[model samples]
Target: MAKCPEDLLLSGCFSSVALIMIKAPAPMLIAVGMYLPFDTTFAVFVGGMLKLASDKFLIKRNADEKQKTIVENIGILVASGFIAGEALTGVLLAALVLLGIPSITSLLTGQNAFEFTGSAMGGWLSILIFGIVILGLIRIPLGALKNKVQ
Candidate 1:
């Protein structure tokens, strides 16, 4: 199932939207089934920041337990990694754009590759076609190797 365009614009995070599509659906469906949207990287980062800030705000909050401290520290580090990775990807994107390669990462998959769209297909249809192409490219090499082994 496709995510409506508005969700993409509002969140500024496409991980669940794309992963719910091209990568995994069952977990996403289960999350949606529970009426809780999966926390995107943005949401998680916000939550992590708030977790720390809110902890600071409340004087009554208990002293940070060992496990909680580990978790919060890890959260901060993970958030930093996500920020760094995004910056690096943007720099790479600018380089690719300058070279005139159609190198945009699809919101559906974080890969850099050319996408195909048939003349008659709508935009969403083109993405489905692109997924099939990606699957084939992945499988054909495996198939060839299997034949050689046989």
Candidate 2:
């Protein structure tokens, strides 16, 4: 006898959202926080906020049609870079696993990445990194605009 997907999904064992979340294209599902931990979801949310702030800056400056186009293009370029980077990283990690790389995560992080948690120092470091990336997203296009004026 075949089991129904909905029966399995809604049997009070799995949450409704989890049942509906995408299963294929795991990377995207993880990136969007549908099938992964909250940290990634939080990061993605913050990136959206950064884009919002960047758009606001452009509006505040009264950017013309061409300027608006340039800013939007820069945002797209940055987002593309992020997606490419994630894909490359995933491929590299997969290859390492296929090649029997020992303790790959530890090798990359000296096993400290997971241990350095719940500390103010770690929290501050995370904030600093997040700020830098967000600022870069905002500044790169603004810099381009400045160059155009020169």
Candidate 3:
């Protein structure tokens, strides 16, 4: 008797963990990619590539094992923070909607709900903000390692 989706366990619906363990990201990409702009997908791809490249660079660096471990731990913490921030933002936006306040999206876009990519200026601004965030992500971990070494 699951009233809400939150209460409904996958265990109850699925007979075994094997079915749950099967990830189908291709189906997800096919379903959602149609609705997203090429810029969005390209940006995601670039971010993933940067992640892979950074991982390789870190492994090849001449830092001692302890320092590398510190950097790795810092990276994990930064990534966890990013994920938590996203979740918290979603929750805050939902709370704003429940409270009848304009969510950040409508506030930023105006009453017309203008898409950020609708104009060149908006698109560039979005890119600038995204770049700044990526810079911050890289900076924080590096700063941590620097401090640990000093």
Candidate 4:
């Protein structure tokens, strides 16, 4: 009986949650990865401000909105839509990474890296570099995802 995906409960919920993440993942990464040498509660506050600025940029650009109701609602509803759309971007980024990395197939299957055997630092550095590269890889998908949801 649903007219569109918006009417379905599970689809709606997941999509909504994705919108939130899609909107401000960088702020989130910073909050989680860096201590910022200050009060942790301030992290949320900082994220909010960054998002506020993002929202303005989004608005100033004159983005095409399928639904007017969503623009007016702001806050949670709009945020969720962005996150939901970004989930697809995240998936795409993962795919691109797998294609780009020669050892991806082995890594996924639990085979360790060649450089990993060199030293303790080698293994540790590989993991660290991998994480950093993954973040960089995700940036494009995140941008694409933002456009899709919005």
Q: Which candidate ranks first by lDDT, i.e. highest?
A: 2
User: Sort by TM-score, best first: what order?
Assistant: 2, 3, 1, 4
Candidate 4 lDDT over 13-73, as tens digits, reads 6655675767855545444444355564553554466456545655776655532223334
Give the CA lDDT, 0 to 100, for residue 54 in model 4: 48
Provide the overall lDDT of each model, using Cα atoms, as 2-decimal numbers. Answer: 0.53, 0.73, 0.68, 0.54
> What is the per-residue lDDT of model 3 for residues 1-150, given as tens digits with 9 covering 90 to 100?
747664335534452344346765454454345447997677557656656765676677667778767766776687678779989998998998898866566666656464555689788888798788778667777678789878
Q: Every model's Cα RMSD, please?
A: 18.6, 7.4, 7.6, 15.1
Worst 10 residues of 2 by lDDT: 22-31
List model 1 lDDT by residue over 31-99, tens digit each.
Answer: 443444554443444444556553563334353454345445544565466568779999988887787
Question: Candidate 3, which segments miss by more than 4 Å at Cα?
Answer: 1-47, 104-119
lDDT of 3 at 127: 79
Per-residue lDDT of 129 in model 4: 69
Q: In model 2, which runs have C-alpha deviations exceeding 4 angstroms?
A: 1-4, 7-37, 103-127
Q: What is the lDDT of residue 34 in candidate 3?
A: 47
Clashing pairs in 2: none
The local lDDT score (0 to 100) that residue 41 gets in candidate 3 is 75
* Candidate number that wins on TM-score, 1 or 4: 1
